[model samples]
Target: MTIQTVTTTPYNDQKPGTSGLRKSVKHFKKPDYLQTFVQAIFNTVQGIEGSTLILGGDGRYFNREAIQIILRMAAAAGFGRVILGQSGILSTPAASHLIRQYQAIGGIILSASHNAGGPEGDFGIKFNISNGGPAPEQLTEAIYEASKGIHSYQIAPIQPIPLDKLGTYELHGMPIEIIDSVTDYMALMESLFDFDKIAALLQADHFKMRFDAMHAVTGPYAHRILEERLGAPKGTVMHGQPLANFGGGHPDPNQAHAKELMALLFARKSEFDFGAASDGDGDRNMILGKQFFVTPSDSLAVLAANATLIPGYRNGIAGIARSMPTSQAPDRVAIKLGLPYFETPTGWKFFGNLLDAGRITLCGEESFGTSSSHVREKDGLWAVLFWLNLLAEKQDSVENIVRKHWAEYGRNYYSRHDYEEIDLKAANELIAALLDKLPSLTGQTFGALTVGSADNFAYTDPVDGSVSQNQGIRILFTDGSRIIFRLSGTGTQGATLRVYLEKYEADTNKHDQDVQEALADLLTIAEQVAQIQAFTGREAADVIT
Candidate 1:
């Protein structure tokens, strides 16, 4: 294979966010903007002159066009082969699965995960490492440096390779393999879960359920699993289509964006016993009951407690982890099991090193992501299936099971309120101000609240001893109540400030109340401590998860 190079100038917005380089479509459409970054990825990585590359995207706006450009560029960059999904549509987890299954060098995932998509919306390109995890910090930094002074991007003058057929073809004498998008992924899921039991549970009508795909990438996977594979009726899956615009929906599976489905469950209250949804690229997830919401913290705890019920996890869990901002529910479980409990930085990438080194088996974040050793990246549909399998084994309703778990282990009341798209500079100022006051806040008493400690979080990766500073600011109270504040890294526009409140009550009498109402007093203290209202100029949060 012969390689070619084309000279070009650097584009300014190549800095990757928490996930990857995400920005408005217009930002990516600049002359040589996408090409410059893609070339930087190839040049910075090793052994790509004649190696296999996997390519696909979330089927968002500009996805197909970007795939075409990338294909030509991959050929020109001297890749020996490219494994692409049909129509270049692969959910994030599926792409990760493909890379691991085929042992490809790495893959380019075209997605601005959970961000809106359309001609006028957003687009993103992320490179997954050979292990199917997001590129580690070093690689991302190298790519960023390369983007700063990129002088050339290589692409061959060739017709667009057809992606609809599942067969092998040759481009510039390089092999290109188009694989069935669902086959390998489905097989993997079947191996990990008990499909027979899940099907039996569906047939028994043990519990009515609804899955909303949010008009994004998970629509097909949801439909195939719930309707075709598990024998759910066709309409049980909602918004089952892949639209560039996400059918005018936000495509985020949080309470704010999925209010419609939430309202339906609350109103009917009879047809649905379980409710779940997946985000745009199929990584984030939200799970609920008819009138009961499963806080992400509680969900992770329950999954960790019952992980042995699943076929793949029947040997007992290896370890558990949660992002620093997430509540300490899993910590309680970890203590019980004598397992290693880890607290990492917010992004899912942090868990990859742990999983790769066998230091942990399961990890989750407050951002509605959960996964295990099954895959490096968070798996949304996988979480749903896990809950389903648990339901089958327990033969109990969602609320009942959660209530029982709380009764046994006590409750960790938790809530996260998000102030979206605030001025970035002002938000940073607010955080800095809070960090400066940490010393004053520590060991102080105000009313019934006595501050136990306060500090800015710094993480030292146990395996490598690498340090990550400024992960977030945290305040702990003598009463076991805590609050954390940070700027969200996944937002596409202005900064998003997230405040997480947590309190543990060992008393069963007060366990069943609503989370926000339970944490009302702590919320007041949090606002006062951080001066959140004055800083953001908003009295209330945009969304609470």
Candidate 2:
């Protein structure tokens, strides 16, 4: 192995956002922009002159181009080997699994998650640590600092490796192995789920299910798992293609983006018993029942309550966790199980330490992300498989099972309304104005609604004890209801204001109301509590999730 350095000018906007360095393709095409960031990643990590690294992407636009650049840089940086997925396309969860399977030093994933993709749209490059999770804060900070003052980046003028072939090649004396993209991942799913049982359920016509892939990375995975493995009809999976532009759709599995699936569910009504979809990169999931939408909050609780039915969770759940802005349903389950319950700041990395420390077996976010000890990251396909296995074991309809759960333990009604792509300045003004009035809002009383408490949420990691300030703001009512406001960290441009509403109702009579109707009053209060109109200068939200 040889070490070298080459001088280059630094580019602005190299700072990574919530996940990674995201920008338009033109931005990444600037002089030495990608090289500088790649070099900074290499420079930040130590003892990687000849270590194995993993490389792959979500097959978005610029994926192949970025892979070539990264290959050249990795060879120049003296990496021993690179394990890449065939066709240079690996869903986010697949890449995480490959990183852990190969025991690579780290992995580079090219994706902007559910964001739009094209030459003119968003592009991203995220680094996952050796533990198969997103790079920790310390490592990300180091990479950012290196990017700031970078004067040069190293690269070899070598021929680009052919990523489409499933074979081994040599690039500057470094081994590049392209493996079957879905084989190992499918095998892992098999180990975690009982395919034979699910097959029996499908063959017996116990339930009718529909799975939408949204034309993103999970298309193949869904086809294999739902159709081939589970013995469902080939047409059971919809939108089964890996389109760079995600078929001109948002590729998010939520109700707003997956309206087609939602309509199909409602049109057929009782025909389909279960419906589910995964977002781009396959890290987020939305689970729906026939004519019933299971909020992410309720989804996590249901999964936790029935975890033992799945072989992977048979040892009993180690613990449970949820993002701070998510409803507190899992906390109640954790209490019942006598296990730890963690409330961490948003982002999947916050749960990494707890997962590594064995403090939690299951964790989820309100943004339709759910996972357990099966993997470090939230896996959309995995969550769907969990629901399938649960359904197979219980032999009941999704709605009936959920209704029974509510009957036994009560119901926690929750909803998150997202105002997407608003002006940054306006969003910040709204948050600032709300913070200024927090003191006054703490003790005020309005009709039947009385403020019980209020404050900005600040988190201190239990395992590492790292503190994250100004996460979000919350206002609790005296009647066991609350409203939370925060700007979404995953958006590509403009701010996304997320307003979460939670109210606990132990009465079964009122549990059957529509969610939007149930939260109608709180939605109004949330708009007023945050002064959304006065701050953002917009009367209506762009989207509600």
- Taken over the whole model, the C-alpha lDDT of each candidate is 0.87, 0.85
Cα deviation at 16, candidate 2, in Å, is 2.2
**Best candidate, lDDT:** 1
lDDT (0-100) at residue 356 of candidate 2? Answer: 92
List per-candidate RMSD values in Å: 1.5, 1.7
lDDT of 1 by residue, 1-545 (tens): 44567788897668787789988898888888899999889889999988889899888999988998898898888898999988888888898888898888999999988888997888998999889989888889899998888888888776678887889888777788988777788888999899998888877745677889999999888888888988987688899898998988888888889987898677754578889999989988899987888877888999999988999989888799999999999899899989999999888888988998998888998788988887778989999999999988998888998998898888999999999999998999999899889989887886788999998899999888888888999899998888999898777889999999998988999987888899998889888888888988999999887
RMSD of 1: 1.5
On the 0 to 100 scale, the lDDT of residue 250 in model 2 is: 85
> Could you give candidate 2's per-residue lDDT for residues 1-545 as a string of tens digits?
44356789876567776678888777788877888999999999887888889888877888888899899899988899999988888888888898898888889999888888777777889899988888877888889889888998887775878787889998888899999888888999899887888888776755788899998888888888788877888788999888888888887889889988898787754688889999878889998888888888888998998888998778788889999888887787778778889888888888999999998998999998998766678899999888888888998888898898887667888888788888999998888889998999977876578899998998888888898889899899988788899898777788899898888777999888887787788888887777788877777767776
> Which residues of candidate 2, in runs, are more than 4 Å off?
1-6, 268-270
Against the hidden reference, what TM-scores do the models get? Answer: 0.97, 0.96
Residue 514, candidate 2: Cα error in Å is 1.9
Worst 10 residues of 2 by lDDT: 1-10
